[model samples]
Target: MADGSSGDSAPYLRVAARLRSRIADGIWTPGGRLPSRGELGAEFGVGENVVRRAQELLISTGLLEGRAGSGTYVRAPFERRPLLRTPSAAGLPYSGLAPFGFTGTWEADSTAKAEAPPLIAARLGVKAGDPCVRTSYEFLSARQPVMLTTSWEPMAVTGGSVVVLPEGGPLAGHGVVARMAHLGITVARVVESPRPVHVDRDQAHLLGIATGSQATLIERTHYDTGGRPVETADILIPADRWDITYDIALPGT
Candidate 1:
């Protein structure tokens, strides 16, 4: 976007664009430390504030990563790995999208029996304080934490059922569709909404990234054919190591 016109873009944006170009140009190889902000400012003829903003933007976009007590460096990019979510033609999608940072296999920890908060209750159409089985899943890819997912299932539907503990039951690795099927609930549909999110201090520690590192949040819900909501979950993905791709098949194609 740098058209070489100073008036066409904001000072920080121009700096960011130039740095992006430099990164793409391989001026600083992957994993190489970038020049310090003061040095970059002098080289680019910009002030420290402008340089800082530029660096922050790049850091957020995964082009750069900052180290504690160390300088910023180019972030290495991995292969475009797939977090597979294959859907069935008639039934709901059986695949659960794994964290983007995963290169091969992953694992998660699940807990239960917590009151559903207002937002979650609203999503599941339950009372604000309704009893639900809550499970927090931290997924690791390539032996590193890449995503966090917290799910809630109302006791009204899953209570007294054998599949109560999502990961412990026989259908543990089968995902939401099969789990619901075990309770005579057929997941006819699934929905997901994704949005941008920046990592927090604790999240950064878990994902081994900076606090302000970029990520995406996906709010997903499963539904039965009768239009009843069965389960709801939130999936967090690191932007630096993950990419999302959607696949849809047209009818009769």
Candidate 2:
């Protein structure tokens, strides 16, 4: 890679661009093993570390995959699925957890009597260290992990009830609206704020992606008819694999 013409671009990024071009030109087909880092380093006239970084950059972009003890290879082509957000037929706001037409299954673990942190407390309109039930979820499509969510519910609301533990008791897995409804509470609204973020190392490992990969974080909260926040959750979606879309119902429809 020539550094003379390009201004201020990192060497690894330049190498990554050249590698990307080669992949686009079919120099390396999908699932085709790439040359060793040392060989690529020699070919690119850069250090092996630089080549490694370049390969990592490509991997983070979903253009390449690295196998343990094996070499890196071009990733197979995959279509981006749309994650639909729409209101339910009953006129309630959508949870935005499961996408429209998604046939996936989810696994969740709920911990009872957990103390809410400051941010979570603020989101739930409760004081820090308030007792809450925390549930962590991993949603999979076709047996592959596609989303992650962590939800917190105030114990003051569900305490002494069958829905105290989200994943336990009679209302297990029924969702916040239904569980609250069982307690004679009406869920009137759901508020979601989505933001783009880079996946951290732990999240990357769970999602089978590279650290620093682009993803979306949705801060979702459920409110009762009286405007009290009942539950709040943070949902993580891989940006490279899915596009988020909203379907709004017109008035009087």
Candidate 3:
């Protein structure tokens, strides 16, 4: 019992709170070694099991990291990144923006005449065997990878056009909306569905994180005025390093 308890919460939760507070207030430095389980139990006047539970709580939140054959240590904190979402108007210019506020660069690779995946095909209103142009983007913040994105555009809509290859000649690096505009398409609005998912092996390799690390998955579709899908993309952001923000505006406001 650190101080007093509400007498309702699990003893371990209270212990976790106390330990979390100490870590926040700089009682321990990042990478600093933690006291042994027995020592922690003694300090908090709780059982070793209780102390272990508290340590587990911190580990889940990334406040503490355990090393194999070594010991648990304070984990370094990461800055939260914001992904801005605001209402977009028709015929507006497109900006190639990364989700974070970090100073860095993005690399995009073009893959042309690829068979549309089932998911991408459904989003683009095309068959699974339809031809499409795929572009993969890796965004790095301060030379550290942060986000991974894959965009697909149906060749049925862009085949043989100047903007057929998204990362191709002249209009390279321009976002989907702008490239679509090259074909006289007027984008009305974009729809995005976001959820939390574990990073797969491919994503982990790109983001430099452990496999199964938590990440945010965003599915976005670019639609023209006639409600036609022009492009679809999957955006992945590391959960530990970024905070997702959606600036929603209510109708008739």
The C-alpha lDDT values of all candidates are 0.75, 0.84, 0.76
Root-mean-square deviation (CA) per prediction: 7.3, 5.3, 8.5
Ranking by lDDT: 2, 3, 1
Which lDDT tens digits does candidate 3 get at residues 1-253? 3344456789899888887877877888887888988998998789998987777677667787554345667876657767665544222243244653446798888888999988889999999979999989888765556788898888889999888987786777667767877789888878888999997756665665556778889898988999999888998888887777765668898
Model 3: lDDT equals 0.76
Question: Which pairs clash inside model 3?
Answer: none
Clashes of each: 0, 0, 0
Q: Choose 1 or 2, whichever is better by lDDT.
A: 2
Per-candidate TM-score against the hidden true structure: 0.66, 0.73, 0.66
Best by TM-score: 2
How much is 222 displaced in model 2, in angstroms? 0.5
Best by lDDT: 2
How far out, in Å, is residue 253 in model 3? Answer: 6.1
Segments in model 2 whose C-alpha atoms lie over 4 Å from true places = 1-55, 65-74, 89-93
State model 2's lDDT. 0.84
Q: Write the per-residue lDDT of candidate 1 for residues 5-88, one digit (tens) a residue.
A: 355888899888888888877787888888888998997788988987887778667787665446777877755555544465
RMSD of candidate 2 to the truth, in angstroms, is 5.3
